[model samples]
Target: MTAPLLGHMMDVPLLVSSLIAHAARHHGNTEIVSRRIEGDLHRYTYRDCETRAKQLAQALIALGVEPGERVGTLAWNGYRHMEAYFGVTGFGAVCHTINPRLFPEQIAWIVNHADDRYVLFDLTFAPLVDALAPQCPNVRGWIALCDESCLPAMKTPVLAYETLLAAQDGDYAWPLLDERSASNLCYTSGTTGNPKGALYTHRSSVLHAYAASLPDSIGLSARDAILPVVPMFHVNAWGIPHAAPLNGTKLVLPGKDLDGKSLYELMESEGVTCSAGVPTVWLGLLTYMRDAGVKFSTLQRTVIGGSACPPAMLRTYEDTYGVQVIHAWGMTEMSPLGTLAKLNWEQSQRPPDARRALLEKQGRVIFGVDMKIVGDDGRELPWDGVAFGDLHVRGPWVIDRYFRQAGGTPLIDGWFPTGDVATIDADGFLHITDRSKDVIKSGGEWISSIELENIAVSHPAIAEAACIACAHPRWTERPLIVAVKKPGAEVTREALLAYFDGKVVKWWQPDDVVFVDELPHTATGKLQKLKLRDQFRDHVLPTAAAASEQCPMEPLDANIDAHAGGGAHPVKSAATPD
Candidate 1:
């Protein structure tokens, strides 16, 4: 190792394999703990996991799993999944993660599209595989990600994951391979529509994980106990599992059950210091803790993403829960993590609420992430907060393009043009106004659905709101506001409309309001406005936009005529359930 080229860039092989080798070589006793058979806990150290992974790799090769063949895993985040993360990919096969939450058709399509030749699934998802196995041609066999006793009683051919590991030589050596070889494939969250697979090379996944581990990003260390609440199938649980082991962090997995009671118990038992998940997960945990009289004396911070965080939601965790919630922003195209909201030390002294307010905005871009905002005309916009524009990002770990999307263009001039419309202030905070598709266009002016949703969540009675653009036939498109009232709470459209007063421009208000049981979410937990639009496309208020145009528009209500601003309110009409 002649003067190991310090500061010089090393590719994915050096980043991934070398780190595991070092861990097995040095910090081998660090534990990788997980909840296995529902209530039962399973644990393994880095030394055990690495050696098992080596054995698994040899087993895969012996089973005729060709290099570059897509190896699918339908397991929860745990020691076994972590081992497969290395075994399949480290041995030169592509790892394809199939989300269990997806509709059966979508799941089948993803697995088929990726040409998965082998599937390693937890016994929990055994029924799903049994039902779909007949349809999946490329999947030659199934490997149960559990011990022999936990194997499902199914007629389909199944191999016990642990049993197979038992038969392998623990000392099998890793074969030398090119750093640029394909390593993993993850599809976009099919929220808006169909999914597309993003091919990750060994070089790309390793690089992205490193950037995520940096201080300005996740800053994971061996001293921290990291729990990933996000499912392993979701962009490799935002790549935390891989990054954590590389940086020697103590890893904890909340397998199978992700509810608050289970997670809280594990966090306390494991002394988990850090966790990452979506807003919904925290919502349940906070609710459970408040009701169950539980406390996390050691839990310090949480990273929340998948959807925007309401300022109020941020306040609860930071003020009431004693846990810091750092809002992050990203897409599947960016290897998932592009921005994190870990504020600087100076701002750390701010009051809890003030700090929570800062957490609402997507914080500064992380290392290896470059962002820009451009208007509809493709010209770059100033960073001034008022000029909200489409966000574009280009980074080393971000997707250059999708896999096998024959002629599709996912990247523009080397930049992965993020469809989010956000504004970056001089201080580097990102205030995302809306998604390009969700922004309602009233007479060519944009109305942000995200703003309405954020504001709606602030109302005492509102649980959630989704503002969808409805065809007006005159104004092109107007907002259709839908709210799901909190349990046993009476919140009419009139009440929600009143709550929005003075907070946003009058013209930004939805022309029609609807109360619904729930707002649909995509597979990744994002609001599905496209589905909302399709659901309500035909049903529109005939007189809503017309009234706005007929009256004299007010200053605060840009599109409203003076008389229009004071015209018959949309709430007076019946809330459209359709």
Candidate 2:
């Protein structure tokens, strides 16, 4: 006979509406603050937010919005945008957050691709909507996210957001939805070609929120005032909108002004205890604080993601400000949160430098996510941390397929290739070496451009740096360091090269350094390496001239600087080809 099975639990589906309802019922008095684009502060409670969200939902349904249809939002992080997120998803429709920073063509393409029936935008994007409306034919209506008095005089007819909500009675109940139904849509930043959409289901979003709010993740609680410096259009502000409400944390939304002074002021005024954003955002805040001779009083911790957090920035935040910096990693495909660098008990007891080294890596995976690295031969690599391979992930919240399967199945044997080259240590810390496309292969040996750039940026004179593979006849490809110097700081190539003398393997050093006024970045503030590569595609290296000018040097061993406490040794310069 078969073994007896345990009794099944409750049959209720995991819906997004339940999160708001719980917050309203239990944490109704908690504050949701916003620095509005209209140059004023807006404050409300969970009760008020839920009431307005319900009214907006009623308005949407009354305007002929059908279940499963897409509703687009082109606005900043504010109470109104939060209401739209719950209103659309709670009503069983998809909330599509469109990045306003994207080019007009790309924005139009995304709107048309999603077949967005209605687009609600902020007053700041009035001209953008007016210009793109002719291109997005499928977008049936435009609604400005403002009151009737504040609505802009647009070329096309547009409705006022507050007026629409005021017309609804808000007595409607949320429909019982299939947990697997699509609730949110976000597109990846199209670095290669056209962008691709990642449709998140209600179940996946809810689970992501739960996992993100755990102690090891964002660690949201009633007492913590959370500020999301990241925009709502990007990966649902890295899932903060949902996670904050689910955990009943005070929400402080920095609307459109993300400058250093603006963010610092918001943090102080709101008594922000924890925050989340990219490194560039924090860089500005740090610079502003340093210039103004200020410090964080209530802010205790920050979660930095979007790109690798520079070691210098991490040290500055911890050593100078007494604030803990949590390094996070994720992408649009993984619901934008895969790992957070939180130390365990044993790791927390380690020496300061050792713990700081661990903090440099991306943290361990949360409970709902699974991670592994595979070699070129399709074999799973060990967690020894020395062998790097293509990173792959699978989880309940991870995407099994993209919206409309734009490029067909993105999974490889049930696991999604994260397109990152990484290594995981015995303690489960993930160290990202580089992107598969960004890794430099020289003389059949792999070199990490990210490592070289990180070390370069640590120099006091350097403001920012990016390393790319330039053409080299002998090694096939050699690293070229492109940098932007700090204001009024004069530094030379030889001095910068000396900074990396003992830090990395001799051959892994950059072949040459070039200073530019600025480096290009993506709309999301990531280095645009592709554009850099294309710009320098046909350029020749300076190795030939250096070889003719310098004396021949001894060849260094393959395992240069391999042992601990090994002294720095001179190796053949880049001029001497392998």
Number of the top lDDT candidate: 2
RMSD of each: 12.8, 12.6
Candidate lDDT scores, in order, read: 0.72, 0.80
Write down the worst ten-residue block by lDDT for model 2: 569-578
Kindly report which residue pairs in candidate 2 clash with one another. none
The clash count for each model shown is 7, 0
lDDT of 1 by residue, 183-281 (tens): 878876443345778777777777877887888787788899999887778777887867887788899999888887899999999999999876546
Error of 2 at 49 (Å): 0.7
Give me the runs in candidate 1 sitting further than 4 Å from their true place.
1-15, 345-356, 438-578
